[model samples]
Target chain A: MALLTAVELTIWVLEGQIPPPIPVPGVKLGLASVVTLAAMAVLGRREAGCILLLRVILGCLFAGSFSAIIFSLAGGVLSWAVMASLIGLFPEKLLWVVSVFGAIGHNAGQLLAAVAVTKTPGLFWYGPALLTSAIVTGAFTGLGAMYLVRALRKYRERRGF
Target chain B: MKRKTVFWLALFAVLAALGAGTYLLRGVAGRRAVVSVDGEPMRTVDLTAAAVPYEFTVETDYGRNTVRVSQGRIAVVDADCPNRDCVKQGTISDGAIPIVCLPHHLVIQIED
Candidate 1:
């Protein structure tokens, strides 16, 4: 569990090092979410949840500014809620697939928060622009996680480290 | 996979088309006195008559955009930032759309 928490932190920092966020409305590589998958795979759900929660909070503190916290927090919290509920039903391999929905949920949550904060419905016009991009980015991140899981399984097998 | 790809592609096309059409086809109405952010009715000044000077600041994350409004027209006469999206945004006659600087949290939308 301690090792996984450290891993989560490492991944969060790595994700942050990916400087200059995409110029698009809502898109991220989400390297930390790959660590999230690993945590859930190796540790049980409870431990994984703790790691994720801490990762998000600390990640926000370290990587993001004040305004960014709102968007990431909404996305992380909503994504975790929905994923936690569905985890029981789906196979472990499906974690990344669920993460896609989580990313979209995060975007939707951020947009809703922005509209509420700004009192502008016209801003929602960005929705279609965001969602289409989300699918592509989500799929890319999901595929990356799939490969990471596959590679991690192989390394853990050989090194037993 | 082929069918799913086709379905998603179609959905994207439709959404893009709708967004573009709505943006371009939006109608403009005649100018009148409208309430602005400061809760004052900004009356339309006669363009052919003498010009009046007005100035306002647009707060942005990177910096601020200072705008000048005169007789039936507005422009970003001075700005601190280089991108100049605020300057190019021209006059915000429509309340529905405002001069938005995404880099900055500033918006100048019209209101009733």
Candidate 2:
């Protein structure tokens, strides 16, 4: 879990350096979520939750912004919950579908947080754009997680760990 | 393709289509730009009437943002926030997407 958390934290911090490929406000690749899903698949829901919580908290400390923590926590928790509930239903081949839903949940949570903090219902106008981005990015990350899970399983079996 | 694969693909295709439709249809050029801070209206500028481009600063308990307005567009020219996402957003001339600074709790939207 600690190793997975470190990897996730690194991806989150590094991903922050790249300007969003899509110029839309609040849109991100959310690559760190690949680790979360993989951990859930390999380890367990509880372990995945622990990794996500640690990554969010430690990520905010590294970013050094109080406001960011709120958004991160909102998105991270919502995404984890959605993926956790759906993880059991989806076979490894269908992990990407669960990931897409989790991605939507993550963005929805962040949008809600933004609307609540700014008290601007107008922010909802960005919802469609966010939803579109989430689906695209989620599919990619889900595929990545699926491959990672397979590779990890092979490695463990080979090493007899 | 497998039945399950085809099902998920069709579902996502429908969703993406719906999202794209709403997104493309949401933007209509408007002359008025409303600036709000912490959900309260702070300023409203009629972009069509502005003969010259001008800038103003919005300072709140959170931070500061310098908003620039021209004939029919608005943007955050500067900000003291860590991310500067608002400034990076460039400008908006339609109701499509508002310039949002999450760090400073600022939003600038163009409306008819």
Candidate 3:
């Protein structure tokens, strides 16, 4: 669990280092989500939740930002909840579906946090753009996680992790 | 079509519909740019009436942002916020999406 948390933190920081691909506010590739998804698929929901929580807290500390923690926590917790609930309904082969939904939930949670922080109802106007980006980015990360999960499973079977 | 394919199609259709709807609704030309801080109206600019481009800096308890107003458009060209999200948002020619500075608690929205 600690190892996974460290990995997540590294990925989060690394992803942050890259400039945003799109020139829009509040849009990100969310590459760190791949680690969370892989953890959930391989380890378990509880373990994945622990890694996510630890990563968010430690990530904020390392990043040295307080407000970011709020948005990250809101999005991370909501995404985890969606993944945990949907993982059971979908077959393992359909992890991407769970991931897509989870990404949507993450955006929704972050949007809510942004609205609350800014206290602007007008911000909701960006919802459609967010949703569209979520679908595209979510699919990318989901496929990445699916490949990672398969590769890791093979490695575990070979090494008995 | 298979059930799974159908489900995916339906989901995509709904999301696309929403995107199209919001684009049409918010992308229309608006004469006014409404600036607000902490949910309070700060100023309103007549986008259509601005003959020449002008820039103004907004400083509040939260932070500072430099907004530019031109004919029929408004945008935050610079900001002190670490994220620089508002500045990166470029400009809002319409009402589709409000340029937001979360750290500064500022919003610039276009309205008819």
True contacts kept of each: 0.02, 0.66, 0.50
TM-score of each model, in listed order: 0.58, 0.95, 0.90
Worst lDDT window (10 residues) for model 3 chain A?
A17-26
Order the numbered candidates by DockQ, best leading.
2, 3, 1
DockQ of 2: 0.71
lDDT of 3 by residue, A1-161 (tens): 68778888999999887878886656788988998999999999999999999999999888777778898899999999999998888777677778888899999998998889889977887888888778778878888999989987998899897
Interface RMSD, in order shown: 6.1, 1.3, 2.0
- Per-residue lDDT of model 2, residues A1-161, tens digit only: 78889999999999988878877656788999999999999989999999999999998888787788899899999999999999999778899999999999999999999999899998998898788888999999999999989987898799886
How well does chain A score by TM in each candidate? 0.74, 0.95, 0.96
lDDT of each: 0.56, 0.89, 0.85
Off by over 4 Å in 2: none
> Model 2 - which docking category?
medium
lDDT of 2 at B79: 94
Q: After superposition, how far is residue B89 of candidate 3 from its true place, in Å?
A: 2.4
After superposing candidate 1 on the true structure, give the runs of residues whose Cα lies further than 4 Å from its correct spot: A1-4, A7-22, A64-67, A91-96, A154-161, B1-112
The number of clashing residue pairs in model 3 is 1
**CA error at residue A157 for candidate 1, angstroms:** 4.7
The TM-score obtained for chain B by all candidates, in the order given, is: 0.49, 0.95, 0.90
Q: Which one wins on lDDT?
A: 2
Tell me the TM-score of model 3: 0.90
Worst 10 residues of 2 chain B by lDDT: B80-89
All candidates: DockQ: 0.12, 0.71, 0.54
